[model samples]
Target: MKRLVKGFAVSLLGLSMLVGCTTQAPGTGDKAAGDKKEQITVGLAISTQSNPFFVTLKEGAEKAAQENNIKLVTVDAQDDPAKQISGIEDLIQRQVDVILVNPTDSAAVVSAIKSANHANIPVITVDRSAEGGEVVSHVASDNVEGGRMAAKYLLEKIGKQGNIVELEGIPGSSAARERGKGFHEIIDKEKGVKVVAKQPADFDRAKGMSVMENILQGNKDIKAVFAHNDEMALGALKAIQAAGLKDVVVVGFDATDDAVAAVKEGRMSATVAQKPELIGKQAVELAKKVANGEKVEKNVPVELELIKK
Candidate 1:
């Protein structure tokens, strides 16, 4: 009977040791789970996803977020200022760590930027900028220089002595304003080049085609065309082709796939290339830095090049 009791005590001792080794103390497992790193969430507000350029930009942002283990929430404004404002407000309500915006209208976005400022959320502008808001950083190509490059190339191709139509982008957009400014600055200096017609197509292909058709009705002697974006440029090309026009030099900004193809086909004279993907990637990187209380430059300019075939 004594031997049996001793053996039973030894078995109980072995079982207790096994449990002590296999199981964690109460609350210890919960503490370990809580000690894991918290995820960072970023909110991206794009002007419109319909445009391929913004699509590429969005892809770049997504790639960066995935690589860095970040949680990204994206909303499309559909090129509506009000929609963009509401989108940002929604992101704010979600308590995102950072906010990135590609404003549809530079001036119209000021109110949204101010709202973000009030919420103490860092705002980073991508591709486009807000005219009157406190932005922590701006990531974009030098659009003015791009405009100048387009004008110079077109003038050279057209011999600097012909009537040209200017196809503008969306009104109140920084891209349109700056690009127009640069184009006119150079055209104004050349005595031989004349701007027969200038109109806004709202950075759309169909609108560009329609606007060009109207402009063609009054100005049949147009020798060249400069569009603020590839969409409008492609539209203008269609209009020119439909009109049975030939030898009209077309210059467009944004070296989109269609634009590059057009250039190779000799339909477009040239296009200014902006790295949309790089802009998106850099914006996310900057947002991450800003969210982590790191200092960064106020303005980061992406490089630009002129593509011609």
Candidate 2:
């Protein structure tokens, strides 16, 4: 009887030890620190997702956010400055760890950026930049360089001596300003090449078609067209085709899928490819670094590629 009692006691002791080994006290294991990883929330305010480029940009940001275990709250400004301002304010109210903005208008977004600054939230601008207010970082392709490449390509196709139309993007946006500057820099140096018509399409396809139609009515001698983005380029192509005009070279920026397909079909002469996805992903990474109190560069530029047939 004494031996059996001792054996039972030993078995109980062994079971208790096994249970203790399997079940550790909360916050006392190798995974305690990992399990307690800080939950980060990021806010993204985009100018508009109506554009395929911005849509792709949002996808990239979401992918990075998922990979890093972050919660992303996104708002669309619908290309309205006031709406963009309101969106930023909403983000600030949410107490997000970081804010990422794709400004509708560089100059107009200053107040919104300042609002974020006042709230002590770090701001990272993607694609378009703000004209005022403090931004921790900016992620985008070199618009000036992309524009220069487009101009050079168009000039080469047209023999550097032809009437070309310039289709501008939204006014006051850094992309439109910088791209125009770079394009004019090259076109100005060539004496034979003249920009016969320049107009703003607001980066809208229908607007681009209408603008091109109006320009074509007055300038039938146009040999090529340079649009700020592929949406406009495709619209211009439609107008050109409707007019039964052939051999007119059309170059564009932001080589979206449709634009690339057009290039493959020989509908467009060429396009400057900007990786919207990469830009968004980098912006999110930068925002994460900022949230973690890590230093980041002022500007992160993704490379641009020329896509042609």
Candidate 3:
């Protein structure tokens, strides 16, 4: 009986040791589970929060991050390239797993990208892509096609023959350049349709108003106006209303909610709706995939729709 009891005690001791090695402590197990959950930090570098398009994009990104269990940090450049570089540097310092950049200047952000690359963080370009780099991916609407769509609508509305003015966006942006190129490519071919005045508004509502006011001084026969973005288009609409111009068709880009309202009200002719939310969602999805060593395409194209009411 004594031997049996001793043997039983030894067996119990061995069993306790095995349990200690195999079982995790309560809090420790919870912590291990939490640690196993995927956690990533994403940096969003955007041009301006002033634009409703960017606002929607930000919202979409935040929602996507939350759904995927990621931490998102957003910084706005406020339309300044230098400020954008500074913002990117700050994001790098934070040691984010990936960066999503909507560059203020395509060329200016190249060095910033190189800096991020040195830190071994993947950079994904959104909206307006950075000029030079092996970025993980770039997601944006087809600006050239949007421009063509707008021009085609305007041409049809004006009976393909009239004087039109163009309020362009920022000088160095790919959005501005492509839109302008596409606009002129179509209108330039129309014999009676003349682009009487063209000026840069820097994609600012107030600046667009000022530029349009100046153009109005010289060109009173303007049959239509095409502003690069909706904000600029809205500004020009204000100017046209103030100038008392009748039947002067106005077209714009980046169909924000306000722009859609404007179209519905018949104050604006049409807008190229570049769905920013979709772009934002795609951008975050691609960033996560790339970070996880999954394959993603270099270029993802977002659709542009011309909304006319």
Candidate 4:
């Protein structure tokens, strides 16, 4: 009977040892189910998923976040400033460790950015920047430079002298403002190039098409076109085609897959390429640095290039 009792105690001891080994404490760097305890949570508020650029940007951020073991929470603003503000407020309510925002409207986003500031949350702007509030870092390409590049390439294709139509992006966004600034900086200096039409398409494809259709009705002598983004460029292309107008040099920014394919097919003259994936990955890395109280550059720029056939 003593031997039987002793065997039972031995079995109990073995069972206890197994439990101790398997059910270790939550955060000892164990590859356990609750390993997220060691992760820093990051909140990503994107402008819109309707645009492919933001979609690719989100994928890059997610990839980097996963590689770094960061817990990421994403909210889409659907290109509405009010929705963006409310979404950011939700992120703040969640008390995320850091915030990466791709603002819909630079001016309108200031209120939401200020809210994040009030909550003591560090914010890092991705792609588009806010006009007001404090931001720890901003990650993007040199949009002004890209604008100049696109303009220069378009001028080269059109022989540097023509009546051109400019398709603008969202009015209040920094990208639209900066790219326009850069484009006019060069085009304004050239006396031979006349701007026949200038209008905003809100950086949307369908809007681009409709706006171009309207512009084409009045100004059919357009020699070249520069769109702030590829979506608009593609839309404008559709309008130009539907109107049976051929040989208009259509240049776009953001070398999205569709834009690149268009360029290859000789439909689009060229496009300025910005590495959105790199921007996203870098933004997450910078956010991690900010969370750990590590120093980082205030403005981080990704490279931009011109893509043509």
Candidate 4 local Cα displacement, residue 100, angstroms: 0.4
TM-score of 1: 0.88
* Between candidates 2 and 3, the TM-score winner: 2
- State the weakest 10-residue window (summed lDDT) of model 3: 28-37
Q: What is the C-alpha lDDT of each candidate?
A: 0.91, 0.93, 0.91, 0.93
Report the number of backbone clashes for model 4.
0
Superposed Cα deviation of residue 132, candidate 1 (Å):
1.7
Taking the candidates one at a time, how many backbone clashes does each contain? 0, 0, 0, 0
Q: How accurate is candidate 1 locally (lDDT)?
A: 0.91
Predicted candidate 4 versus true structure: per-residue lDDT over 194-301, tens digit per residue: 999999999999999999999999889889999999999999999999999989999999899999999999999999999888999999999998988889999999
Candidate 2 on 1-309: residue-level lDDT in tens?
999999999999999999988888776655643343377899999999999999999999999999998899999999999999999999999999899999999999999999999999999999998999999999999999999999999999999898999999999999999999999989999999899999999999999999999999987898999999999999999999998899999999999999999999999999999999999899888888888888999999999999999
Candidate 4 to truth, TM: 0.88
Instruction: Summarize candidate 3's per-residue lDDT along 256-305 as a digit string, tens digits.
Output: 99999999999999999999999999899888887787888989999989
Model 3 regions lying over 4 Å from their true place:
1-37
Task: For candidate 2, give the lDDT of residue 117.
Answer: 96
Candidate 2: worst-modelled 10 consecutive residues by lDDT: 28-37
